[model samples]
Target: MDEDDVSVLVASLLRGDRRALARLITLVENRPRLRDRIMSLIYPYTGNAYVIGITGSPGSGKSTLVDKLTGELRTRGKTVGIIAIDPTSPFTGGAILGDRIRMLSKSTDEGVFIRSMSTRGSLGGLSRAAYDAIALLDAFGKDFVIVETVGTGQAEVDIVDAAYTSIVVVTPDMGDEIQAIKAGILEIADIFVVNKADLENVEATVMALQMMLDLSDKGDWRPPIIKTVATKGVGIKELLDAIERHRAYICETDRIEKMHYKRSKVRILEIVRSKLMDKLIRELENSGELDRIVKCVVEKKMDPYSAADEILRKLDKK
Candidate 1:
């Protein structure tokens, strides 16, 4: 699309047009060339939405919990935007398990907007376009934006960078006690949720989490462990309450400002690194230098580090 077309969409989005918002998100995701213009247009309207991240291991009922949480948020007269990151399809490279299908109940709600994205070979449990999508939702005037990461256990810590309140969900059967001690996931949670509370060993799971929290130096705010049965819409309100308390704590202490500064630093550096790498790879491929380097490495003529340095040197010369 042209610059004028993008301007029109941004205008529509600012007027709370859901179709325009969807179109803009798709444009940002698929057409990276237009991302800078689109983001610049919408950046001024963002920072109004509160972002919440829900992350956990596979089969932790995270989707069900998010569904319930969105319902509750709507009841409280809040417009909610959900970004569910799903695994990438090997064949099409699209989202394999469509979260929008799972959240069909909210499909018709005007106040609730849902979008599913594929991890697309990106790590840390989120799609590469996730940050951009969040910005679009925030700019579209949602009161709350919820990001549910692909359930990949440890690597999901990246959610902390994107959310003001980060929730880590676990189940009674997941052997989470051991998982907590081993993974960095435990360190990032603002709230720990033991979903499937009706199952056996629920107390054990809670105790394990409690023990871990006691051992860690959480400073002034300690993570609360809440038991939930998300399939039955249980403990969802309490979870939301916990989230609100954390939100209040951060706001009162002015830690939110610190978080925003840190996230901005990380986001800018990541974008710069990604853009530089993409440009370098394109240049190497077009000039056949990448192939020549690979051939030399294969034949043991040059080491990999030397090959990399040669590529950088050539780029510097150009």
Candidate 2:
């Protein structure tokens, strides 16, 4: 779509045109021109939405928690947007889950908008399209945007940094896994949720998490662990309370500066890495070096590590 089309869509979105909002998200997610144009058009109305990121291990009931929390938000007269970040097909770069099956119940609700995105090989968690998708939801006037990510803790934590408040979901039986994952996942959590509370070892699970957090020394923002049986909707209130408490803390001391710094540094590296990789690949293609390296490895004349070092040497030259 063109700039005029984007203008119409943005105007429609502000006027509460739901169809226009969907079209705008599609436009933004696919076309860069439309993405930039639509974002600029809706810039005035942006930042009103609280972007909440929910992430965890594969079986941690993140989807269920999001479903329940969003339902509660809707009942409280708030609108919600969901971005379910699943893996992309290696061949197609499209999401494995074409739609969020768990979030589909909200489709009929005019107050809820759910969009799906692929991690799209953007290993830092979330695709290039995700930023646009979030912007679209923010512009569409959703009071809250909840991003649910795929994969285990690390991948989830990376994406949730963009959120105003991040909830790290875990289950009662994740003791060993939690210890292994603690280093990466603990740092990003604004609120830590131990879902599946009805399962065995609930108290032990909470104690383990708290003990780990205490050992990590993440300063004064001690992450509160809330236990929940998400299926039964138990402990959802405490989860929301923890979110509010963190939000208030962020505003009072204003980590907006720190958040901005963290975000910018990550983004700069993403851009630099993309450019560097692109340059390396092009150099390989031009040098006929990639084919030769494969040939050398097939003949057992050189290993993969040496081939990579040679490639780096070639690229480092002017």
Per-model TM-score, in order, reads: 0.93, 0.82
Alpha-carbon local distance difference test for all models: 0.85, 0.80
Least accurate 10 contiguous residues by lDDT in model 1: 92-101
Q: Report the C-alpha displacement of residue 313, candidate 2, in angstroms.
A: 9.7
**Which candidate ranks first by TM-score, i.e. highest?**
1
Q: Write the per-residue lDDT of candidate 1 for residues 131-183, one digit (tens) a residue.
A: 89999999999999999875554337777888999998888888844554434
Model 2: CA > 4 A from native: 89-99, 268-318
Output candidate 1 Cα RMSD.
2.1
Q: What are the clashing pairs of model 1? A: none
